[model samples]
Each structure stands twice: as C-alpha cells, then as structure tokens.
Target: MGVVAAERIKLTSTRSPWWCAALVIVLGLGIGILMAVLSNDTEATQGTDPFILSATTATGGVSGFGVMIVMIMAALTVTTEYRFGVIRTTFQAIPNRAKVISVKAAVVAVVAAVVVAIAAFGAFFLAKGIAGSGPTIRMGLDEATWRVLYGVVLYAALAAVLAVAVGALLRQTAAAIALVVLWPLVIEQLFLLFGDIGKDIYVWLPFANINHFLSAHGSTTADFHWGPWGGLVYFVVFTAIVFAISLGLVNKRDA
Candidate 1:
C-alpha cells in the first residue's frame, strides 16, 4: 500500500499524466461534438441500431489520439526515471521490481478507466444534445453498448500497460512510444488497408481484434460480429506474451 501510494505520488507530481488525461477527454469530446453537430438531424428509427451509431460516433475521436496519449503516458512513466537516472534509486527503494511494475500498471489502469469513462460519458451526452433529441444514448443500458464502453476503458488501460511493457523492454521513451504507436498505425493498418477482403486480417491485429470485436458500430470494418466472444483466448494469449516479454527484460536488464 505504501509503495503504491509513493508511486502514485510520483505520477501526480508530474504534469504528464494529468495533461495527457485531459487531452484524451478533449479529443473524445471534440470528435463526438463534430459527429453530433454534423449529423444533428440523424434520427433513431424504431428498427435502427442506436448503440452502433453511438459507439462509432464517440470512438472515432479516441481512435488515434487515445492510442498516442497512452503510449506517451506509459513511456514517460518509465523513461522519465531513466532520464533522471532515478531508476536505480527507484529500484533500491522498492527492491521488488515486479511489484513496482504492478504499482505502475495499477495506477495506469485506474486512471485510464476513470478518465475514459468520463470521456465516453461526456462525448455521449454532447453528441446526444447535438444529436437533437430523437433518442439519447446512455451508458449501461444494453449489453453491446456497455460492453463496448467497458472494452474502451479496458483498451485504454491496456495501452498504458503496453506502454510500460514497451518501456521496460526498450528502456527509451522515444523508441518505446514509436514502436507502440507506429505498430498499429503503420503495421496493423496495413492489414486492413486492402479493405473488404481484410476481415480476417482485421480480426487478428492487437487493437483491431479487441476494438473490432467489441465495437458494435463496425468502426474498423462493417463485417465483424458483436455476437459471441470469438477468441477471448487469443486476447489472453497475446496479452500474456507481451507481459512475459516485459517481465523478462525488466528482470535481466540493468537499471
């Protein structure tokens, strides 16, 4: 508990976490507002899909910026210590490198969850207002909408963990962040850039797999099904592989 508190203090003392979080909220709201204002006349028909539209509407803003901020926050959290040559002291103070990692991951998970939920809520309501009262999208109403919201929050936290994982593996913020962000934008996008026939490929990428599966709106592709957990095992497997790599590097590398 004490160690967690101390680690939390380090995060709070720095401007990066708060600032990055704020940026996420702003970007989410901005995109939501844009979509809402542009399609204010869109009406939800009785037979129409409300969750689908709402999910696509709000997440369009977070798709790019949120990933970038997650990488930045994760990189800064670990690399900032390296930059200050304070990692050695951090190691000495904590003595349990794994626990330190856990604390860092926890801080990220909690903060990301809260901030993302807020962003989702804000975006939903903003879009609701601008969407002109035909129907309002609220959180926790249906399985699909709530599932996507939960997944978004989880994705944000996972991005943070990914940041820390990459940071531990590489030990440089620049390289870590580049690898994290670039992999999705350049490498992963290459999978779906072909379009139409890329459904199988789209269902396999890291973010794509999770977001595409959870997204009721078909943001990534109009093909993925929101029914049944297609490959929950696959998600667990990938997360485990990445996490193991992080643990290995952190244990072997010199502080």
Candidate 2:
C-alpha cells in the first residue's frame, strides 16, 4: 500500500504525465473534429448507416492516437528511472522488486484510464457537436457507443501496462520506446501485407487485437472473432505474460 502510494506520488510529480494528458486530449479532440468535418458529406452517407461514420471517426480519433502517447508515458515510468539512476534508490526503498513493479503498473494503469476516459469522451462529444444536424450526427450512448468508449479506456490502459513491462524487460529508454511504439504502428501493419498468414498473425498482435476490441461493429476474422470482450481478455493475457517475464528479469538483475 505504501509502495503504491509512493509510486503514485512519484508519477504525478513527473512532467511526462501532463504532457501525455495534453497530447491525448488535444490530438483526440482536434482529429475528431476534423473527422466530423470530413464525414459531413451527406452524399457519402447515401446508402450507409448514418451513425457509423460519426461513431467510427470520433472513436478512432482518440483510441488510435491517444494510446500511443500513453504507451510512451508507461515506458518512461521505468526507463526514466533507469536513465537518472533513480531505480537504485527506488529498489533500495522498496526492496521487493515485484511489489515495486506492480505498484508502478497500477499507477500507470490508473493514469492511462483517466487520460483515455477524458480524451475519448471529449472527442466523442466534440465531434458530435461539430457534426451538426447531418447524416454523420450521432449523439447518444447506444450499445455500440458504450463499447467504443469503454474499449478506448481498456485498450489504452492495457497498452500502457504492456509498455511498462517492455521497459522493465529492456531497461533501456530508447530501445523500449521504439519497440513499443513501432511494433504496433509499423511492424504489425507491415506484417499484414502477407495475405492470409499476415491476417492470421495480425489477430494475435496486441495492436490488432486492440483494433478488434474497439471496432464499433466488432471486427471479424476469416475464421473467428473473439469479439470486443474476448479481445480484451486476450490482450490481458498477453500483457500478463510479458509482465511476468519482466518481473523475472527484474528479480534476476541488480539495480
């Protein structure tokens, strides 16, 4: 409990959290508004579902961009400590390696959740407001709407946790940050160029699973779709595995 509280305080004291929050909210709202504007063409909504464009645009704006910053923040939570030689002090203070790591994870998860909630909801409402009385106007919380909003928060928090695990495992700021950011943004998408095998492999990637989880209509696979909730479970398991490996490395290595 004390360790968790200390970690929370430490996290709050850092400038990264504020920067991350600002970026998430600013980019989320900005991009969402842009999407709303672009999607305002009623002719485009001719035969399609009117609400889909608004929902997809608003949701994608935040979840797509906001979570990437959260991943960087998570990685820095540990990597920054390493860079500054603060981990030695932290380890000396906490002693229990796993406990300290768990606390950091909890703190990062909470921060990520809060940031995602604000950014996502702000994007949703801002887009809806800018959309005006048009075909792309969707202003209520339907089942799909709930899924998208909830999915943003869940996906962001999970991504943060995974990044923290990666940071802990790698113990290098630049390498961990690059790996965490590029794996989803570039690598996995590149893998999709291989057709069937790529698609199958994409299903297992965290970022792909996140997209599946947050898809407004619930994404489909060639053979199966675990659905949003199932995708969440899959991501949790994946994060847990990486976290376990990180913890093992932390236990074995000296600070």
Candidate 3:
C-alpha cells in the first residue's frame, strides 16, 4: 500500500503525465471528429454504397497514437526517476527492488487503462454523434463493438507494463521512449516489406496480434492460428516474458 501510494504520488507530481493525458484526450476527440466529418463527406458523394463507421475506425486515434503517448508517459515514469536519482532513494526505502518495479508498473498500468478507456468511449460517442442519423454509421454497443472498445483499454494497460519494464531495463528516457514508440509504429509495419516471409512472421508479432484482436471483421489480412482471444493471450504472454526478464535484470543490476 505504501509503495503504491508513493508510486502514484510520483506519477501525479510530475507535469509530463498530465500533459500526456491531455494530449491523449485531444487526439481521441480530434480524430473522432475528423473520422466523422470524413464519413459524412464520403456518404454525401457516394451513389450506391454508404460508408459505415465501425468501432475500430471511430477509436483509431485513441488505440493508435493515444496508446503510444501513454507508453511514453509510462517509460518516462521510470526513466525520469533514474535520471534524477529518485529511484535510488525509492530502492533504499523499499529494499525489494522487484516490489518497487512491480508496484510502479501496476500504478502506471492502471492509470493508463482508465485514461484510455475514457478516451476510447469518448471518441466513439463523439464520432457517432457527429455522423448523425444514417444507415452508414454503426456505432452500437454490441458484442463486437464492446470488444473493440474495451480491448483498447486492455492493450493500453499491457503496453504500459511493457514500457515500464523497458524503462527499468534501459533507464534512459530517449532510448526507452524511442524503442517503444518506433517498435509499434515503424518497425512492426516494416516487417510487411519483406514480402511472404514478413507476412508469415508478422502474424506472430506482438503488436500485430494486438491489431488482430482489435480489428473488425475482414479488417486484418494476417492468417493467425488462433482467434482474437488467442491473439490477445499471445500478446499477454509475450509481455509477461519481457516483464519477467526485466524483473530479473533489475534485481541483478545496480540502481
């Protein structure tokens, strides 16, 4: 309880987390409006088929860039502590290095989950409201729609845990942030450039699986051995392995 409280205080006392939160909100709502406006325009010009807005399209910014920003904030939480030598103090107070790291990850993960959930739903409703009365807009709280909405929150929380682990391992803001941001946005996409082999390998990649889990029907072309739930489990297991490795290294290395 004490460690958790301390971690929360450390997270909120900083201005960067607040700024990141605001940016996520802006990205969520801003992109929602953009998608809604575009859908409206597409419908206006279309002759036969109308443009249908799925849950996936509506929350694109929240799940994509918003989640990335959360990961950056999560990485900064640990790297910034190391930067100012606060982590050493924290270690002295907790003694159990693993406990401290675990608590930090939990705190940040929870906060990220909550923030992204709000952003996800906000984006969905805002987009629906803007797109207004149409056979094109299909933003219902159906099973699939619910999955996409909450799946984003789940992914954000897990991604935050991964970011915290990366930060603890690297203990450098720039490197950790760059790796987390680029691995998903750039590096993951680059795998597709390798042609058939890349496509095969892409099915097993962590973020690719995440995309599969969040995607609407026929939205993703990757041929996976399992279903969306299985893809999520694969990502969960991968994150656990990385986090476990970081825990081992953190205890073995100096603060």
Please write out the lDDT profile of model 2 over residues 1-255, one tens digit for every residue: 889889888888878799888999899888888777766766665574443454656867678778888999999999989888999998998889999998898889989999889888888888777776654566567987888888789888888889999999988999998998788889988867888988888887877777777777767653336777777788889999999999999999988
Selected candidate, larger lDDT, 1 vs 3: 3
Sorted by TM-score (best first), the order is 3, 2, 1
Q: What is the TM-score of each candidate against the true structure?
A: 0.84, 0.92, 0.95
Residue-by-residue lDDT tens digits, candidate 3, 95-196: 999999999999999999999998999999999888886666778778889889999999999999999999998999999999999999999889899988
Query: How far in Å is the alpha carbon of 2 misplaced in model 2?
Result: 2.0
Model 3 ranges off by over 4 Å: 43-51
Candidate 1 residue-wise lDDT, 1-255, digit = tens: 988898789888988888988998999899888777655444533345443246645666765676568667877888878878888998898888888877887787688778877887677677767665444443334777666666667667777777777787788878887888788778877776687776567767666666564565444354545432553345546766887788777878889
Clashes of each: 0, 0, 0
lDDT of each: 0.71, 0.83, 0.90
Q: What's the CA RMSD for each of the models?
A: 3.9, 2.3, 1.7
Residue 97's lDDT within candidate 3 is: 95
Give the candidate number with the greatest lDDT: 3
Poorly placed runs, candidate 1 (over 4 Å): 41-52, 133-140, 194-201, 217-228, 231-233
- Ranking of candidates on lDDT, top first: 3, 2, 1
